[model samples]
Target chain A: MSVENFLILGLGWAGIFLPTALGAIGSIVGCARAGQAACGALLDVESGYGRLVGASALPSSQTIYGIVVTMQLNRQVSVEASPGLFALGVLVGLALLCSAVLQGSCVASAINASKSKPEVFGLAIAPAAIVEGFAVFAFIFGLIISGGIPGTLAG
Target chain B: MPTATNYYMLVASLPRMPRTFEVEQVPISRLRLQQRLEMLNEEDTTTVQQMQEFLLWDRQHPDRTDTEVLQEYEQLMQRVRNVLARKIIVYRMDVRTITCGLRRRRLGMDPPSGVGQWVQAIRENWEHPDFRLARQHPWIPLVRGYMEAHQPLQTERQLLLAIWNQWTRLADRYYFSFETILLYLARWEIVDRWTRLNESLGRQHFESLLTEALGEHARFPQ
Candidate 1:
């Protein structure tokens, strides 16, 4: 593919990935706030299974978004033409995938925690934020590579 | 004619019990009224502290089941209700107790006397930890302000509206908190046995008390 074509494609992918990642971050933070409130309320007074059930249900959407973005990036890379570019793309994609998987697992654990203690929901947030860091690194790296590829490669 | 002091001491000194199945057998209506009284009396040092202690113990001992903790809480609440029912002096004292619990705290050390003090007191009480957590949202201050400012008097219609508004706000907070916790749990996959057991117990105690309180007004309308 031409350099412009590759650049355009990469930019398109970035466009989708960036916004979704940002949105996921927002949603995660909102979920965290909700978790804090839930735990606080549970501490103040118990609300039974209803409280646990409700608190456990709020984090899945963001996890799914993270997974989808990384998977899509994996699909976008071309291995035959440029091995280095392809490898970098795969690395970034894997980074994103790992973050999504870890974050998703954290969310699940948090739900389980809420079911029993609802009070400890606040404690579940640290893991989710940690996973977000990996996603951020992968995203920034991918953007830089995509930006540079257009300039260095011959059409 | 047990004095408030006597009732206080009894509740304070009541021995802790192990898990029991009596909770399931107990009529929800009776439990509901008793729970309401217990919740209101949460401000009472004797009762609130005990409840807090029970919760703390359950947290420490993770082997306890939700069903067991809830049953014990119900029994305690039943005992409290029975005491309040049997003694006229205690009952009247409880009325004062409820008023005090329900009374708003003054924003300033010395709020203007009369209606203003009462209004401010309600505002303060609403903002207190127990009632504040029930609503679990940023909107409490605004809603509380409106309720305090309106001070609907005399008419049952106005009173109902005020109560409804307060209830709605509390319900919103309750649901929001629930949703938030669910999201975190789903993310974390936290399947620890002890944490789950404690949570279930805490939830049971909370619900049982709320149901007991709400049921009373419905069953016995003046």
Candidate 2:
């Protein structure tokens, strides 16, 4: 293949994979932050260890959503399609990234709050769940946007 | 991605501390706090250690002279990397200086014209109660009241609690950052100091009071 064609294909591949890459990166950071708090909460209280750990894992949902969006974006990935792929994939990935990391902070705060006031545990997690909802919005929209690109399942 | 230096785990592991003087006992035991402190990165751990050293009730260096201690503290301000730490130290200096001025005035001594940071503040506002600082620090008036009343315990509690409250505000501002951990340690030291006061020093105060009362009663003077 020509150099231009190779470059286009490479760009397309990057676009196709950006969502997963960025999402995973964000999830890794987010999970680690929340997990650290969970581990800390475990030190403070014994019985709620399971719940804290569960809450910490909430950020990981963004990564799953990113995967689904990327699967939907899978297609011929031609020069014509690469720009759209890059735009949607990167935008969705960034949204997922921010949502996951921000949710991690929220989860950490939740853990800290609930460790002291156990009654607020359920209420504390509501914010984190809301953050995940934003990521899902990006994921579903990314899938819808992917349908416009040529040779994709929707196309 | 990995929160290597962030204090989320350490802060979370520690129990929520109540207001200063609210509890006689610290929420976390020394051993447990030490274990949690081990999680701090080398640099922040050093900062915490250095700052804690300055938290001793009288803030005196037993081995070092006053000049040397001031020099050491000046060096600490330069060496500590955190802005919050520097700001806290400056705030502490102002508080300590005001307290010193209060004590010197209580003793009818002129503000010493020597190697101190706040001699100027004291000398300039020598005649003014609260040393013109009452507006900035409303507690200045209260601290002055306690000092003049010869209520050292109350004076100390007020001073320490003020410091504790300052640290609390600083911690709340930085919430999840490493600065929060630093402020947490500072506040913890205040709680520890309050609780520790009820032991040896408290007994000494009580004994002294009893002796003074007996001495007053045994006034068989010509």
Candidate 3:
């Protein structure tokens, strides 16, 4: 095979893996941000450390969704699959990345609010959940689009 | 050296301050606030601390002059980078300028324009109630009214409330950022100062009333 075909197939693999890779990147940033707030909140409050840490972990779901979506996108790498793979991978990755980062910010806000006013704890998490819902939308649609891509099923 | 300010942690550690000076005392003490701000690098902490020291009412030593304060304001404006933070410093100076203008005008010290345009405008428009800058600072008329009534305490409270509200708006616009931390410190200082003033004033009021009551009792017909 020519170098052209090899390069094209390589691009296809890159695309197939982008979602998981990008999602993990987003999760790393998101969790770090939320975790910092959690640690800060711990300094001011006596209890509820468990929930703050749990909320910080909320951004990790993007990685889980990414992993599942990656599995669905798994197919025989080809030039034909490359375009579809790259588009799907880059878009989903971007969505997950932004959502996770923003979700982390929302979680941090919730933690900050709750630390001062514990009564608002349950209500504040709603913003982070809404952000997570957007990420889920990206994941669900990515999974659906993966099957429609013109490629032979890996048996 | 601290690599970053860890603004998120710093901001999160601070309590939510009200938009106005409604709190009787600061939610966090100055010492504790300083401790949390220890996260900032030494250089930044020095700058921030220096800036916070400016515009304090009682900070003026007998020898301190207006030129010194104005010079410090310019120096701080150069050192600080954030636009909102810079605006905060300017707002402080504006408050000081307007108050000074009001007092100087009342004292009948009308002179030629020597300072910034705003001061010059205050001088030039001595005849005008708001100095033609009423739109920029709507509270000017209200402050003028208090001054006219010779209610210095009310004027002080109004000025403090205005500053508190400005800091509150800046804090609300930005969160988990460096400027937000600065704004928090500003509000905390206001709260701290308000508490101190209230305490002193309260003591003075109680002492005066007690003395008056005792004097009246002693003078009563026997």
Worst 10 residues of 2 chain A by lDDT: A146-155
DockQ of each: 0.01, 0.67, 0.65
List candidate 3 stretches off by more than 4 Å. A152-155, B111-117, B213-222
Q: 1 or 3: which has the higher lDDT? A: 3
Q: What is the lDDT of residue A140 in candidate 1?
A: 67
Q: CA lDDT of B10 in candidate 3?
A: 76
Q: How far is candidate 3 from the true structure (C-alpha RMSD, Å)?
A: 3.3
- Candidate 2 chain B has its poorest 10 consecutive residues by lDDT at B110-119
For all predictions, the C-alpha RMSD in Å is 20.2, 4.9, 3.3
lDDT for position B35 in model 1: 42
**In candidate 2, what are the lDDT values of residues A2-75, reduced to their tens digit?**
89978877877788888898899899989998999999889899687788999999899888888888888888
Residue B204, candidate 3: alpha-carbon lDDT: 89
* DockQ metric, candidate 1: 0.01
TM-score-based ranking: 3, 2, 1
Give the TM-score between model 2's chain B and the true chain B.
Answer: 0.82
lDDT by residue (B51-115, candidate 2, tens digit) is 77666635454565557657777787778777877777778877877787788888998774433
Error of 2 at B2 (Å): 14
| Model 2 C-alpha RMSD to native | 4.9
After superposition, the stretches of candidate 1 with alpha carbons farther than 4 Å from their true spots are A1-81, A151-155, B1-222
Full-model lDDT, candidate 2? 0.81
The TM-score, computed over Cα atoms with residue i paired to residue i, of candidate 2 is 0.88
